[model samples]
Target: MASRMDRAQAVVAIGELFREHGYHGTSYGQITAATGLGKGSLYNHFPNGKEDMTRAVLAHVHGWFEDNVFGVLASKTDPMEAVDQMFVQVDDYFRSGRRLCLLGAFSLYDVRTAFDAEIVSYFSRWVETLAGCLKRGGLSAKESKVQAMACMVDIQGGLLMAHAFDDAAIFTSSLARSAKTLRAAMGDRVPA
Candidate 1:
């Protein structure tokens, strides 16, 4: 008799595969092979099939992101420094060891409807959080939201470009330029 796999293990395994190969690239067979589970075992855990498994992966990644990135931002008292630190953490994560942004990859996947709402909600929360940090740094509500969204887009776009080109330097350069632009926009508003 095959031992039943835990839900947490399955979620982590699926997320790792998705992170490496992306949505369209990864297959159920690959997942099964990674998890060392049979077809029936996979279905037993995720009755809704790949959609359910993807959702689980998203949720798992979201939690990990919040812990690593968002948590760092929220912990800092200085908003400007916090925002800068956020980007630093992002760069570090991507360059740490061939680590690509899972959310960014998932967003570009062709199966748009599969996890749209969840992905949107997660990103919306991230933007709002960043906007709040900007507001703390003296930007007005509208300005804060705009700056936050721009930063988010810059990071995601830079990462995609870097991944596509197989060049980490491109990502780092884009982030540096974005940081400079952001600081210049803040100008006298930024603390010494």
Candidate 2:
């Protein structure tokens, strides 16, 4: 909030602000304070205002997961490795359950209606790619998808529980349970 920031920097700050305060809860005044940009300067970077900022944040998040998670899952020859990597990537990305998932946050409000397509695609793409990886590991397609969905559920729910309880171990245990489910399915050969 004290230094000059380009558009990308502004978007990252805006994203953290939005994550801390839901879409409806955040105001332009807060954004300006967060980014240290005046209305005129902010408008110059985002002509469409908040909508443009949200789009940029979503795109950044999408691209990161695409390269680091979904894409990794889609291309890895070793399905178990890919799945294990998925959990590691996710754990790091969320800062060990201390950070909120931007897409999940966005999906919790009326903002969901505005960015519904993006939100749906982010979650669905993750499941699909991971399911594909599991199927390659010899899980039946249906079972693979089920396991992927369970992981997703555990992740989202774990984040919520961690935030509510202020306990990262709860989140850790949730992920372990998810991984355990897959490990059980895979005959206990999943990598640690």
Candidate 3:
């Protein structure tokens, strides 16, 4: 159990590095330095080394989004309010767009084979949850799904822009627009 906990901590520590430098950019030396675990122990915990760590990081990211984002969306009874709360949660989670999204960041790397299916499922579940919320708020099924997809595109695009410009406003503004658009589908008047 102690080894399991140590491995979990190592995965989290490595995940933070991957979030900033991406999979290809992150190295075993860096992971060792970050976790203070020598090669022997590192390989002991992750027999497949970087590949294992990347998979663990992806799993960590997937679990976090499921708990922090989708869980909120699922539990809210008021859909528009749920949309509103989700944007707030997203804003906080991303640290106003300063924090890189591990899943989105992974897409830029050649290591997608390590966890592409999980990434797709994470994104699909996110959109499906949003679509369900929108449908609850009165949008037709097709419209709900379309708007959900748009929201996700805007979010990932916004994150890219935020990183490129070194500005949080880009992501925040896009999130606001996403929420407003979702609300508008419910015939709610969105403030300008």
lDDT of each: 0.78, 0.88, 0.83
Q: Ten-residue segment with the worst summed lDDT in candidate 2?
A: 183-192
Off by over 4 Å in 1: 1-6, 187-192
Q: Say which prediction, candidate 1 or candidate 3, comes out ahead on TM-score.
A: 3
lDDT of 3 by residue, 20-79 (tens): 788878887778888888889988989998888888888887788788788877777888
Please report how far candidate 1 places residue 84 from its true position, in Å: 3.0
Q: Model 3: how far is 121 from its true place, Å?
A: 0.8
The digit string of per-residue lDDT tens for model 2 on 40-123 reads 998999899999889888988999999999999999987777778988998999888998898998898889998999999999
Instruction: Give every collision pair in model 2.
Output: none
TM-score of 1: 0.84
RMSD of 3: 3.8
Error of 3 at 183 (Å): 1.4
**Top candidate, metric TM-score:** 2
For model 1, the local distance difference test gives 0.78
Q: After TM-score superposition, what is the CA distance of residue 23 in candidate 3 from its true location, in Å?
A: 0.9
Segments in model 3 whose C-alpha atoms lie over 4 Å from true places: 1-5, 188-192
